[model samples]
Target: METCGSMSPYWVKLNASNCFIGIINNVDCPENTTGLESSTVNLQLTAFAFMITQIPFSVVFGLALQDTENTFLLLCGGCSILVFLLFPISGILAFAGCMLILRDYPDLERGWSFDLCLASSILILIEIIITLIVTTVMGIRSSKRKSNGKPEESVEGKGSSKDGDTQTQSNSYGHSIMKFAQVAITNGAEAAKNAIGMK
Candidate 1:
């Protein structure tokens, strides 16, 4: 029998003399092997970590900014984080139960194990679908706002013009009117001086 870690749900035993290693999957293995076959495992692990670490940070940051435009998005992101957390947690528990059941009985089919592996895969697909729909809707709304001639100005003080020449002409007309007023004033002052000198 192998010593069990407090975090692990199951005990692990290795019989090196007989080249046998058995993991009694009672505890959750939050860390997965880093290899091609276990890529989903790694992804789920990373997502779980993000749920625990990044989600709260993101929520706090969003609250600090206090942006009404991003309120819905922040909430959705928070829900996604919750889903990520719950899915893996439930999966780990289910996997642990299944392992314990299989350990007691020696005649489990390979197909059942395959099904267990696919659970995480299905959850990942669901996450992807949800993200796609949310992002697509946001993108469409943004495009619509841009097309309505109310394009949001960038932080760097750059703006898009619906008609460049129209803006330029408007600016030019204001400048011309100011110049004409100044010239008129100067001419009137000169005429007054000439009249006084002649008098």
Candidate 2:
């Protein structure tokens, strides 16, 4: 990276060896190079990994607390709670350490814990998107399957009830037509008689 990058003493100027050394030893720059914080900065990044990875541990601790009959489980859960409380202090330390590392360095990386944090964040986002897609698909299918699901008999299905409805409608229509024809015929006869001056 240092070879590829322009020749200045920034993060991008780091070589591959420096990455391994800086990340492992928690140093911000190469051994000879005076970049950022002291050597212990890398160790502090362990906090980042824990921060991203401890969700399941929190659940486990909660479950452990529920085990009333098991003394060992209770002890473990209590310790876990203690650790959880301590996590913030640890984060503060890591933040301070990271700030020290970042104080001079312009870019991220050369930090091992950052990798874990980034990876976990991306994984969570992907999981959420997939979950939402599946849920939406299922919901749509369920609603379509559930809504307006009357039996075939309700909508001109081949059942006695459907047949009855159709028959009733046709019969009423026929009756109306017959009555109208009768009225028309009676009016025509009356008009013809009147034209000839009959009562």
Best by lDDT: 2
TM-score of 2: 0.34
Candidate 1: where is the Cα deviation over 4 Å?
Answer: 1-109, 151-199
- Which ten contiguous residues of candidate 1 have the minimum total lDDT? 1-10
Worst 10 residues of 2 by lDDT: 1-10
What's each prediction's TM-score?
A: 0.30, 0.34
> Which digits, one per residue and each the tens of the lDDT, describe model 2 over residues 16-103?
5544233333235545754335443453545555554467668778778778787857677767776665455444545455455555
lDDT, each prediction: 0.47, 0.55
